[model samples]
Target: MQRYELAAVTGLDSLTRVERDVPRPGPGQVLIRTTAWSLNYRDLLVAGGRYGPPRAGCVPLSDGVGVIEEVGAGVTRVAVGDRVAGIFMQGWIAGDIPGDAGNTALGGAIDGMLSEYVVLSAEGVVKVPAHLTDAEAASLPCAAVTAWNALVRESGIRAGDTVVLLGTGGVSLIALQFAKLHGATTIVTSSSDAKLDIARRLGADHTVNYRAQPDWDRAVLDITNGRGADIVVEVGGPGTFDKSLAALRPGGHLPLIGVLTGVNGAVSTAAILRKHIRVHGIYVGSREMFDEMNRAIAASGLRPPVDRNFGFDDARAAYEHLERAAHAGKVTLTR
Candidate 1:
């Protein structure tokens, strides 16, 4: 088998491909043959030592889909030949995140799916929606699940509510789709007009080019006639946190999902208190959330946008594409 491991806590240069023997599953585990993988901004952060110091030889990807090639003793949740994707936190099955969930995160705390085959707990994987291609299913384990958690789980997003998406990245684009599915008015912001156009085609009710309109919060207010959005998918971290607060109506929801901008800065808390804004820090989601999200995708026939695809051997190029932020949606690798 072939796998890419982070040889040291350096940058992309540390991503080393090496040969390894395919390991077998243990009791209550399953062996998976990977069919597809997707790159998230977190992957770049992990690879570049921005997320944290990862374990040496950590396989660096949290999102991937594969088929069950074999099951260990007492396994029954999934069977051989079933297509499945590993959940982000293998320990988090349902309810609130466990304290030790971080230790179970793939690619960061443990070996991930950037290999020809992987062994995971049978309970840690969920069967993907059958309508999706392997690459599309691969995209769900991180970005899509996070979007679902923010909108469908955390925020009780209702019809006629307004949602402001920070960018056209994987999470934002998938959130846009989910927001539309729930009949909410969607406003998407992006630096690129081409990407904004893509968001529009994906059911965004309005678009803001942050590059053109730097004060986009006021634009959101203007779009809503001085009323503000009901939810702001806050992916920009401290760089855009204040503006996200400004764009939200009183008692609105803010799901803080990413730190695409710098992680730390002075953020005014007065607005949050004054406006009664509900803020939730989302860390991907649980396997139960994955199952619920898959049901929604299957029901609505939702197809997540794939910005680009690379051959499995071209993993470096895929990472470079994500690092450049050139994609408007998920960037994937397929066997």
Candidate 2:
């Protein structure tokens, strides 16, 4: 088997490719031949030593789709030849997140999917949607699931309600699709007018250039006729959290999902108390959530956009591209 390992917490150069013997699946485990993988902003943080120090010699990527090559004893959930993707947290099957969930997270806590072959617990893998390509399915485990958990599972967004998305990253774009699928009006914010135009074509009811309008939250209030958005996908942590609170209607929902900005910042408990807002901290969800999301994706025929595809040998380049933050959607690597 061939794999890329993080030799050190340095930069893209830390990801080194090497060969090793493929390991067989244990009881209740499944071995898969990885076909495609996707990069996330978290991957960049891990590689750059910003997300926390990863284990030495860890395979670095959480999202991938592949074909099952073999199944171990007691594995009945899937069979050989089934196409599947591993859940972000192997231990989190349903309901509340368990205490050991962090230990089971791919890329950071354990060896991930950036390899020619990988073994995962059968319970931790979900069948990919039939209509999506391998690259598209590979994009789902982290980014798409976070978006689904925020809008569908946590917020319970409904028709005619307004939803605000913070940026044109993978999670935000997928949130736009999910919001529109549920009949909610979508408002997307981006620094580039070109990206805002693209968001409009993708069903965004309103677009705001945060660079042009520094107080973009005011724009959100105006668009919603002073009532404010019913739901806000708050991906920008401290830098934009206050504005996100101001842009939400009283008793609205704000699912805090990302820390693209710095981790620590001023938070207004007064506004939260005064407005009677509900703010939920979102992590990538469980396998059951992944299954439900796949069903909705299949029904809606929603294909996640792949901003660029790179060959397996160009893995380092792919990381650099994601670091540049120039992509409009998910970036993928194919074997």
Q: Write the per-residue lDDT of candidate 1 for residues 235-266, one digit (tens) a residue.
A: 99999999999999999999999898888989
Q: List, residue by residue over 26-125, the lDDT tens digit for candidate 2.
A: 9999999999999999998888777755576889999989999999999999999999999999999999989888888999988899999999999989
- The regions of model 1 sitting more than 4 angstroms off are none
Candidate 2 Cα outliers beyond 4 Å, as residue runs: none
Query: In candidate 1, where is summed lDDT lowest over 10 consecutive residues?
Result: 48-57
Q: Among all windows of ten consecutive residues in candidate 2, which has the lowest summed lDDT?
A: 47-56
Best by lDDT: 1
In order, candidate lDDTs are 0.94, 0.93
Task: Tell how far residue 58 is off in model 2, in angstroms.
Answer: 0.5
